[model samples]
Each structure stands twice: as C-alpha cells, then as structure tokens.
Target: MLKNKGKRAYRVLDFLHEHVIAIIIAVVVLAGVISTIAIVKGDVKTSSEKENSIQYEEMSTIYFAMDPVKSLNPLSSQDRDVYYISQLMFSSLFKLNENLNIEPDLVSSYTANSGSGTVSIKLREDAKFSDGSRVTAEDVRYTVSQILRIGDESPYYEYASKIDSVKTSGSYSLTITFENPNDAALDNLVFPIVSSSSYDDSANKIVGSGQYAYDSYDSMKLLKLKPNTYYYGGVPQNRIQFKIIQDKTKTTGLMTTDAITAYVSTAQDADSDAEDKKLKVTKIPSSELEYLGFNFDNKYLAKKEVRQAIALAIDTESLIQDNYGGAGITSDSVYFPGFLGTENKGDFYKQDQKGASELLQKSGFKDSNEDGILEDSKGRDFQLTILVNSNDGSRSDTASSISEALNQIGIKASVKKVSWAEYRSEVRSGDFDLFLGGYQFDKKYDLRSLFSKSNYLGYKNDQILASVKKLETCISAEQQKETYEKLKTMLQEELPYYSLCYKTYSFITVKEFTSTETPTFFDMYRGCDTWKWKKVVVTEQKDDE
Candidate 1:
C-alpha cells in the first residue's frame, strides 16, 4: 500500500509540473475577478451612503408675498408686486442697485454719444436665456418694439417713445438713437428684456435671462420659482415660493404658522403676534411722496401768496407724527430724501402762523367782517376745500388737520374725503381748491408730468420749464447738477407744490433671517440671496462596549 501511494504522489507531482504555467494563469484571472467584484460592491455601498446622507439633509424654502401681482407681463404690468416678480424672473438691460443707481444687467459695457443722441450697448457673450439660448441685440430690439406697439397703455411707453430707432449693430451689440438728448435715457432702459421667439403677447409665462425662471402659478394662489441653471448669475440654494393672500388678516395669520416664512406689512400692522412669533421687522424708506397738491386753476390757489401761506400755516412735523404715526420723513422738495437734487434749503415755508398771516395780509386778504375769516378784495370769504382720498386714512387725517390749522389762522378751510376714483377725477380735472395726494416718483426724476402746462396743476413757468428742459438735455452730471440746483432754488421760491413727506414701509421676516440693507421699493429682494438658514444638524450616539 505504501508503494502504491508513493507511485500515485509521483504521478500527481509530474502532472502538476507539466501544467503549472496554465494553472498559475487561471488562479491569477480568478483573483482579479474577485478583486473587481469586491471593489464594485464597496463603491456601490459608499455611493448609497452619500446619497442617503444628502437626502436626509433639509433644503431651505423661502416664501414671499405674491398677492399684489396682477400680471406677469413686464410690458403691460405696472403693479408693484408684478414689478418685484419681474425683477426675479426677467433680466433687464439695466438694473437699479440698493443705492437706486442704474447698473448694467445684460450689457457688458455701453458707450453714449451725447452729440448724436445715440447709445450703443454691448451684450455679454455668455449671457443666455433660461432655455440656454444666447441673448442677442435682436431680443432687446424686439422688446423695445413691443413696448412701443403698446403705446401709452404700457408704463414703459414713455421710455419707448424717446427712442427714435433701435438697430442691431452686431449679433451682441445694439445701437439706439433718441430724437433728442435725454439725461435719463440710460435710466429708462431698465425695462426687462424677453425672448423674442418665446413671447406670444399672452402674459402667460415669462422666459428671460434673470436669476430665476417661472415654474408654475397655481390658480393665483401660489407662485413657484426655480433657479435658472442657465442664468448668467449663479444659481441660489433655496427655492422661492410666493403665496398670494390678498387679505391682510389671512396673511397675518399665516405668519404664525409655518406656511409663510416671511411677510411684508406696515409698521402699524406689526402687532404683538409678530413679536410673539419672533418676527424681525425691517423699515424701508418709501419713494411715495405724500404731499398737498394744489389746483393751480383755482382762483385762490392760483395766487402764489395764497399757496405759500397755506404751506406755512400747517405743521409738517406734527402732521406726520399724528397722521402717519411718525412713520414718514419730512420732505421739502419734490424729490425723495436721497435723490440727486434733494437738499436742505433752510426749511422754507416752515410752520409760521404769524408769517403766514402777514403774508396773507400783504396779499390784500383782510377780515372785513367780525367773523374772523379772511376775505379777498371782493369781500368773499377765503373758504378753500381740501380734498383727500378716503381710501388713505393717513392722508384723510392730514387733510382734516390742515383744515383745522387753517381755520385757526382765520382762513376758512374744509376737508372733503372723497373716494379714490372721485379724487383722481377731481384732481385730473382741476376741480378742487386743494387736494392731499401722493406721487410715487420714478427713478428718472422727470418732473415734466407734474410741472408742465398740460399737468393737473396747470402750472407753467417759463424759467422753470426752461430749467427742466435743460436738465433733461444736459450731457454731463456736473451740468445736470448745476441745472438741478438752480431748479431746486426756483421751486422753493415759486412753491408750486408743497412737497410734504416721503412715506416709509415695514417688512416682516422670521428671526432666523436678517433684514436687507437699504432696501427700496423696486428692489425689495436686494439682499435675499445672502439670507442664511439657521439649520441644526443632529447625530446619533454610538454604543461603546
């Protein structure tokens, strides 16, 4: 048996020696296959773990108000809410920063020829629409053409009317010629640009080169916006969801619940509940100029002395405090506080009842009767009716206060609170002696609409008109500044309109978010991209044995 086993071992050794190279190749191949399978299984496990970790992390969502938007069409809509949404979803040739200064949006650079009244805008090569298509000068020309076609119906028509022609200089450059030189021509170009091929004049959905793209609007209740991957600007992390709740009461209620992440409200609307909910309230200086517009056609108001006296009799500080809840800044000029032409002209026409009375007396108004009411040369009592929009509680209160103050000064004044429609009709028709109205001025600072001969006030001064025309035509900022300074002095002396105050607005957000710096009406989301989410991460403890 030992000999037979020895012979078998010897045979096996000989067979192994003969096939050793082939066996070695087979073993190496099998080892490589096993190693590859192990590596693939390990990679799959690691990928699954990474994906699960990312899925477990929460993505932040931001909610804003969309109730005020009536239409999404940039050319047709003038609603503030619509403007805000357009700012997000549509890219303009230019945009205003937090300082309210015009900056380039789609244009990489621009050149203006003041002598020729032409502007050439060079588009960025990489600027693209939401659909990843390149933005061209033809798109801008098409937008301007559409705005012009709308005529006076579009808010941008005024700007469009200034353009004599829009021609594409190149694939990425556009040259626009104006009929006349305009200092605000670049400022007027801030209107949004839409894709020429996509627009159907339907106001359905907007497609542009803005930072965001329209996703969906659910029956006017909610508006969903997504970051545009093709945006010239980088994409943001949080998705924006705007809730359209028109009722202020309902909006306030949503603030307490998690339904709304942020809301905008007046300071007066920031109640205790907002505090309990730990909302951070931010105040923004409004561009809305609340002033007392006089019907210059009125016999009494047509007299500069009468208007100046009325301006001096009322206390602007007291009126702002009592009527506006001290939520407004006193304004002495038609321009807003930070506007280019705004200045302190030694507080002209301040509350000076004695001066007002002396001025009235010098103007040939006297108390002919013992009734203590001033009368003109014809012995007619100087009774002026002050009209206020009934919809605006603050303006109505201010009108009442002005009437009381005038009555105290022996000038018979009465308050007439009229509906908004009626107030507009009366003011437009010059049917009121005095009216408490507010004007939300555009960034252009064009006063032609308020001071021209065809204006509601019928106020036309040759020197003033000439100054305004010069300011519009002025080529350089220095020249514009010099002209505006002279215009300001003239406006102060003439007292065409009593520039009362600039209103303020309040915005409410969760305590986790910080308020934007120097927010304006046009750029409410100025710093929204920098908003941080205070998220907390939790980890499970491991058992140690």
Candidate 2:
C-alpha cells in the first residue's frame, strides 16, 4: 500500500515536471501547503514567534571586564593592568601568536648578534602606527630608553633589566644590547612598543600600531576602544568595550540582556547562566594558583608539626569539589597545570583523617574540654582566624570547607573576610596567622616573593632560597626542571602556604560570537577579524494534510 501511494505521488510529480512553469507554480503551492501543515502540526512557525535573530553587524560590541585596578601607564612597565591594555592597543617586535608561539608583528625578522650583547632587528617597512606615523627603529630605541629611565615603576622594568642600551642603526634597524646575556632576552623583547614621541607623556596618548585604538576613557570604570582601520594586521570587527562591572550578578544580567558579550573572572557565575541556552561557557587553564599562607612570623605556625597537622586536617580536594563545584583542579604543588614548573607525576598531598588525628596528637593537642575540639597540652584550643579577600565567594566557601575539615580533626577554625584593599594591608602587615592568597607568576617564574625574607609570611628556608637562585641561572632545561622539582618538594615540606587549588579561568560569550579559550590582551580582537554572525537554520517536518 505504501509503495503504490509513492508511485502515484511520483507520477503526479513527473506530470508536473513535464510542464516547467506549472511545476514551478505547483511547487510553490506545495511549499505553501507544507508550511500550512507545519503550522497546524506545531512544527514550524514565523521566526518572529521565537527569539529574535542575534544582531551581528550592528557594532558587535563585546564587553570584556577583569578584576583589576584602574590605571598605570604602559610606559611604567610594572603594572599588569596597564600592560594588558598596552598589549592589545600596541604592537611589539615580537608577538605571541594563537599557539602561544613567538611571532613577528612590527619587525619582519630578527637575528641574535653573537658577542655583541645585542639582538639585531629588521622592522617591517610598511608597519605604521594608527597616527599614520611610520614605525621606525627610533620608536623601539625610544621605548626601551623610556623603560630604562622609568626604572622599577615600568611594567617592562624586570624584562628590561637585561637591556644595557638600545641603539638605532638607521630608520628601520635597531640593536638591543643586554646587560646580562641570557636566552630569555629574545622572549622578553615581546614587550609592547610605545611611541618614542609620546614616551614622556605616554600616560595621556597611548598610540601604537595595533588592531584597536583608545577611543575613550572613564576615570576608572571603563576604557572604550574602536577598530583602527590603519592597523597593519587584521582589522577588528567592532568597537571593543572594557567595562569594570565587578558585581557577578550585574555581569550575568548584562550577558543575558546582550548588553555585554564577554566577561572575565566569573567561572562560578557563568555556570549558573549556561542553563539559559543563549550563552556559551568555557573553562581554560590559566597560570594562576590560589594558596593558603601559613604565617611563619606567628609563634603557633612556627611549629612544623602544627603546619603538617593543619595540612593533613584540611581536605583540599573535597573543598574544591564541594564548595567550588569542581570548577578548578586540586593543586598538589605551587605551580599551576600546563606550566613547566608543575610537578605532574608527583604525589604532594592526600587526605587522611586518621593520619591527621595522629599528627594532631603528636603536636600535643588534646581533647581537654570533653568536646570534640582539640586543645594543646596547655589546654589551649587549636583555633585560628583565616583571612580571605571578601570579593571571592568561591575562595570564601573553600575556606569554610577547610574550616569544617579542620573541625573534624578537632581544630577550631574561623574565617575573617575583608575587602580586597584591607586584605592586601593585612597580608603586608603580617597580621594574620592564616590567609587566603593567590600569586600571578612573573615572566621569569620568580618564586622569590613567596620565600624571600621580604615575604609577608616571613617564611625563609636557606636551601629553598638557594634552589630558587639556581633555578634562575640554570640554562639547561633538565637542570631547570631539577631545580624547580627540588623547590616544589621543599616548599611542600615547609608548608608556607598549603597549596589549595588551581582555579580555571573562564570567558563566557553569547552564541553569536566565536572566541578562543586562551585570551591575550595583545590580540584580543584577533578572533574578531574573521568573525561573522552565522544564521542558524532550524528545520521542521511537515505533516501530510
């Protein structure tokens, strides 16, 4: 019966095809008939009945925000907040490509000048700044000179510490002489270029030869940017909006309303918004590690047994999974995952409640009050105040979980959450026995701040310090790995900061945009150059009428 019905339908279609115009008209009518049937069957409807197609060409404004301070001139070199902006709006001789590999941006080619303490660079003749000024060797010379004169205040100061001088041979060639000959010099040259003409007054005019130019600025709330058509590389799609909408709820709301297209620092909140079906969430591995610093300055924390007991009592994995909803990787060492220093194949810490009880008992803690809480042999309860920056709920919740775990082992713990500014003050003043903190690794991967005598924790181990210095000068990758491994082992033993977890950084965008997981301020709009709104097609089956 089905085959005979198909044969009759084929015969009718063949007769319709025999008359071309009639077939066209008949197909149009058939399409209308199918459309009516689809409507009746509740399978297809007018697009106006559904969500409006996402606006694509109307200045695809992406609101990108970060938890950062307002301003520091890029020329200052030391300020990340400023460097991040500089990286986007400006270009350097060397640039990191999508694969995170070094590539040329302003300069066409480079060669190491052996024995001359210099690296010779050949500039791309056509490269010109947004102001229509030709990017010359003098620009590089002047930028390096400004960084040297600016000293420690510049974001590039540490990177520039190797540069003895920058000499321009001609309009298109430059020589970068280093104070110390190191292989990292080539990598450090990736510093964003600033116009020599504006170096003295760079804070006002941050002109460069990059994808976008500074369009407008708010006192501290925002920095608006527009595409620079004169850009030597790929042109950006639309005006870039950098907003400081720090409130998580406000950020989520903006994304839902299409007021913003991208945001930073909200893995916890983005997860909540993913259910809306209009948003896309991605977790990317970042070189960020959160830690709990144990105060070496405090008499109670000076005891190694006390530190070990606390470490054993705190269940970092459970804290990360339960409180943070598994948004991060449980850290066993100081270095974050994907970093070279990360001790991937080693065992650092594991949960053991029985072991924790034994460690506490050995540390001379007794349950003297008949309550579950343990006290020192002197009947002093093992209680301490934990301080964390109040802005992060995930960190606060992790702290609360740690507190609960410690209580399980008879250690009483309380949390003290404070404003970020106050938290910084507390960290610097050595006012807390324990504090929740995180570190952003410098280009050199320096751990000096954490173990140096100048550190907030006042934790100093001679061997660890020696190993760090060795880690700096070691040229061989194997030697470097050994030194880093040794340092990690020692740091874990010292327990300066009970390494908590490496949190995943997320960048959430709407379905209309295409973005990459690894973000770079230097080329924030690199993805935008080719991005176009794709019309998503949804098809429905028509019912026979």
Candidate 3:
C-alpha cells in the first residue's frame, strides 16, 4: 500500500515539473518581445530629441590666395585685410561704431589730458577674454608696452611714438603718459591686447581675447574658428570656416554653390553679379582714398604748376560715375569726409578740362608734333607713368580712366600694372614717378603721418607738420577741427598727390549674420564676439514636410 502511494505522489510531481518548464519558456518569450518594443521606442525618442535640440551648424569663410601672416599680432602685416582678420582674433581698447564715432569695447570710456600728453582709460569690469581669464588694466599696460618694445618697425610703433609710459592705477583703470602730446596721441592708443602667456611661435595657433579662437588653421588651405566658451559677450556662431579661394570669380561661384555664406568686398561693387541672387548687399562708407601720388623727388613732379595741371586734368566725376558705379564721392582735400575737422565745400574742386589744358600749356606742354600729344619745351613728351597694383580693381580701373582722360587733353599717360609687392617696393624706394595708391584714414583724421618727413612718399612740408602738431595738442574739439581744416587747405594747394575720390565699399552678406555699424572704416569685426546668428532656413530639410 505504501509503495503505491509513493508512486502516485512521484507521478504528480513529475507532471507539475513538466508544466512549469513550459510556463517558464512562455514567460521568457513574452519578456523578450516586451524588451524589443521598449528598445525600438527608445531609439525613436532619441532620434526625435536629437533632431529638435541640436543647433544647426553653418560656416562662413573668406578666400585669399595669400595666407595671413601666422600671427594675430597687430603689428604683423600692413595689409588692411591682415589687420581685419587679426581684429577678429584680438580685442582692442577702443572701437569705432557705425557712425565712425568712437565706442568703447574693452574700454568703457577714456579721457585725454592734452596738456600732460596723458590718457586715462576706464575698462568694463565684466570684460573677460576668450580664455577664462579676466582682462585687467594691467593687460592694457602690458599690451602698450609690448607694442612699443617688440613692434619696432611696426606701424604701431610709428603711431605710439608719443607714448613714454603706461601703467595701471586700479583694477579697471589704465593711464598712458606720452612724452610729447600729438593730436593723434589718443587715436594711436587703439590696439589689440594679447596675453603674454598665450603668445607662442606656433604658426597658426592663436590665443586671444576675441569672440572666436583658433580651432584649426592650415597654411593657404583653410582657417577654422570656434566660438569662445568663456566669452563675456554675445557669442558668434558655432564655427567660422575660412577657405582659401583667391580668385574673385571663384569666390562668387562658391557663393552660388552655397559652399560659402559670404564674401567681404575689396571691390567697390562686389554685389554687381550673379551671386546677388543668394546674397543681400550693403554699402559702407570706406576710409579708403584712391589717389595719384607723385614721388616728391621726381624732377617732373617738383614743379608746382606741373602738379597742379595733373590734378586739374583728371576728371573725378566721370571716373566716379563710370568705373565706380556712381558710388564714389569727389574728394576736394586730403582729409576724407568723416575726419573730425574736415569741412568739404563741394565747389572747392571743379572738373574743368579747359582749365587743366590752359595750365598744361602754361607749364610748357604744347602740341608741337601735331599728333594730339603734348611735349614740353625741351621736347620731353608730357608723358607720365602711372603705376597701379594689378590686384586692386578700383585703382587699376581709375588708372585706365585717367589715362584716357589725359590722352584727350594731349598728355601722354601710361598705366603700368605691377604686382602689389613690386609696386609697394617701387613706391617706397621712390623709383616711380606717379603711383596709384590708397591711404586708409584712421579715426583721428590725422594726415601728418602720410605727409611726414619719413613717410612712404617722403613728402616733407614744415607748414603741414606744424599744423598737425597743433591739431594734436588742441583741447577743444572745435580747435582741433579748425587746425585740421587749415592743414587740409594748405595740403590741397601743394597737390602732394592727386586726390581722385574717396571710395565707398559695398559687401554682400547672408542676412543671418549681423554687420558692423555704419561708415564702417573702423574695425567692423570688433564686436564679433558679441555677434549672434539669426535663424536660417536650412534648405537641406524640406519645409513643407
């Protein structure tokens, strides 16, 4: 009876064990199905979040055949573009706003003590560099010292000649004392500040107090900048990519292809082509002045009447309307329109071909050969060589137009096209007679440097120098203006160079990016750290969908 009962119990236990195994298998299968669904749902949710939260990345680049001199140091290159690019990587004590008015960037405000040749600057306490370091008055003093010490042959040295000492009085205050007070003394203080620690000899590495810092730069290839995480102000877009496309035509092509977002203009009319379809163009008053500068030592240019005749003969208005697309303004004097003390009364200059011809005849140039060409009394043809940089479109065009105009007046004018380097060398050595060049006027409206004894042209005028000195020392703005006006009238009479026109520059940019303020001669890239990108429609994604 016991064996039979045990057998029944064992049979029941065996049956239950078999059913439990089947149930366990079913539960495992069900769990696997549920886990698969959860994973699929999580993946879908992650993809949606990525699409919604990610910032759209875009890049804007400028093309130039020449690579920027590896340093963002202000004293590195004299080229305006080099300075421009460096401004993006460096911060200045003072910056100019759209109206060509002085606006403080790193500095909140500054006062000039004309009598002591001293300048006191107040900095914004909240100003911090691209690095996490705070920018202090000590940085300003150090920058001034570095510029004066290391920048011997630099343009900065020439501008900062008056500065004898620089020191910090407080955490946010800086004092600069000049040995001699010059009118352009305060203006010369505008320079980029760099940390002594970050400055290294590495070719493309940049550590700056700017809106952007170097992400990567391969010589003559591409330069990439990423927004500084520690920036104190508005940050630029995620990245800025600079591609090296030297050919202007190719640059425009890249714009059409959507490979580049913008192109800043070196030409007056950069928007006059096919790329306009994708870009909006804005014109800014340029500080650039296109002129015909005679090597002062040139025998032919030494004659006052000869210089006057050439100035009179050039038809500025026709050249402005034709080559400049009616975008240029006639310059009556050396000072451009926006200078502190410049007074331009339009009638001071007249485009009188008849008057020019009379002056030429009086200067001993006559149509002796009946070939419609003038020759001097000594049979020296009234011919002049006008040199221009081949890369400069505006200057080259103006040179050609002037040649034509001179031909009309029986004066033989020849346009000599040369590389910019060669032209600069020739102009500096005083080897050429008349060269087509441009002077970029700075914020102070100082022309003394241009006409100084040791300037590029080596043109010396004591009267002009004295006037510039007075303008620098004058405490009152009105007094400074009066002094500058006096100097302009005097320089205009001398005709050191034929001031053709003050050019206006136009640029086409993507509307999503903010532009520098008006009369944009001052550094446009100053507040780049503070520039924010507006929303852009990424055409890569379908809007309708």
Name the candidate that leads on TM-score: 1
1-545: candidate 3 lDDT, tens digit per residue: 99999999999999888799898999999988887787788743422233323234444443223334445445545655557666677777765444333446787777878777887889887777776777888877776666666666555666565678878888889787888766435456567777665555334474677777778777667777777776666666546676765565566566544566555565655767534565667665577787878877776688777778777777788878887776677766766664563556542446677887888888778998799989878887777788899997877998998888778888788999999899888888887778888888766666667767887666788888888777655244556666667777887788787777787765555555564432255654444433434434343332333
What is the lDDT of every predicted structure here? 0.76, 0.69, 0.68
What is the C-alpha lDDT profile of model 2 across 423-485, one tens digit per residue? 999889989989988776654455656677798988878888877665544134455666676
The alpha-carbon lDDT assigned to residue 523 of candidate 3 equals 57
**Residue 244 in model 1: shift from native, Å?**
4.5
> TM-score for every candidate vs. truth?
0.74, 0.63, 0.62
lDDT of 3: 0.68
* Candidate 1, residue 541: how far the Cα is off, in Å: 16
What are the clashing pairs of model 1?
none
How many steric overlaps are in each model, in order?
Answer: 0, 9, 4
lDDT per residue as tens, model 1, 1-545 = 99999999999999999999999999999988887787778743422233212112333777776665667787888776776777777888877665344568998988877668788889988888888888999999999999999888787887778888899977898888888875435777888898988886776587888888888887558888888888888886668888887765566567555466666565554645576667666666677888888877778788888888888999988887798876677765776565553454434678999989988999999999879899999999989999888999888889999999899778999999889999889888888888888888776667776777888887879899878776554244556667777887788778888877777777666555653353566676665654654422345443333
